[model samples]
Target: MLFFLPDAAAAVRAYARLLRPGGRLVLSTFTEVTDADKEWFQHLGAALGPYLPASPEPAPGSPPPPEARLRTQQSLADVLTDGGFSDLRFAEIAHRTVFARPEQFWDWLWSAGMRGMMESIAPQDHDAVRTALTALVAERLRAADGTLGWTTSIRFTTARRP
Candidate 1:
């Protein structure tokens, strides 16, 4: 089995060109469903009402979501077929990515493109959202070291073709 990371789609396509018949491509990636911390993002969306587009955004200092596309099983199948691959199988599972604090959470969201989405929130709501986020992290999500942990769903997709 061969393993690949994001940009894997491109890699798969490339490898398909060079792969001998019967070779396989196995891969998966991060997905938005992983945003089980939706409540936090919801707070950000509610706060950034004006600055963000119709989509949600993360608070300042947060990392934006990655640019990789989130594909459904069908989509993954299509991608594989279009890439000259066949016999596709895909599975999505919940995974936790832990952060040490609300600050750390904010940091990743900012860098993640999620921040642009959050920038639209109204300034007046920022403090309220911020406080609620802090409380949420402190009350339920924090690890022993004081970092916050959130669920991020990932899809393990694989395919083979002759």
Candidate 2:
């Protein structure tokens, strides 16, 4: 069966809910320390200006923007155990999505259906941020194709219950 869960905790629970006797679940999400998450957020913030905010709501529950609680792969495995899952397998995959020019970033942001949240920024500021972001990408990612290069931290784990 194919199912997608945005909520990490609930995803585990749902995993056990299905999967007949020997069902397979292919799970993919961010790892607590996948790598380069901070840089990606920084890039997004520079491009979003005030809308991004200086510091996110500093509290326990709920994760700060960009830096959500994907912390540690081991904990995810433990959560699976708690959810009555066995035969757990984990793999590190490179889901590092990167963009080159500001236009590319903007395209990804909007066309990718992830732009809804970014609408809070003023139009002018958004333009300025995009301008600055163009340079930022140019500075950071220097590929032969003139595109940015960055790595995203994603951990792909699969588990089954017997």
Candidate 3:
């Protein structure tokens, strides 16, 4: 099942309450936000000036979110154990999702997490944002064939309820 739990330990404890003894729980989440992702947000912030305080990417040296902490094998295992889970296992899934056209990328940006930011942008600035975003995306992700590529790193964590 997909979970948006931000507190790894709380997530583990909650899962433990739901699962019967010896039941298994498997979940996947991102471990880190790459520099390219930060760049994308930075570009977006620039386009929507004064609308956003900062990029979505957490500031450097700040405490990482729970998902980031769970990226560490030891941290995940420890949390699971403390929450009554045993036999924890982890695996990494790396992949690239390509948008065949810029429109597809824009569609995803609007439909996915970036939707919230869209509401904050003034209607008049939409075109400008799009134009700037297109250039930014083209600079970083445009491929020889014209598709835009996004690489993702996901961690799949599996554990058995003790």
Could you arrange the candidates by TM-score from highest to lowest? 3, 2, 1
Per-residue lDDT of candidate 1, residues 53-98 (tens digit): 4645668965333443444566567667877898877778887777
- lDDT to native, each model: 0.64, 0.64, 0.73
Runs of candidate 1 with Cα error greater than 4 angstroms are 1-15, 31-40, 50-70, 111-147
Q: For residues 43-132, what per-residue lDDT tens digits would candidate 3 score against the true structure? A: 766756754445587688766644345556676778789988888788888878797766566667788656876777777777777777
Best by TM-score: 3
Model 2 lDDT-worst window of ten? 1-10
lDDT of 2 by residue, 1-162 (tens): 112234656767776888776776666666665235567667666656556545555588644444344446676677777777888888886655666454576656666435666665567677776677677667666667665765555677788876
Angstrom error of the Cα, residue 27, model 3: value is 1.0
Better of 2 and 3 by lDDT: 3
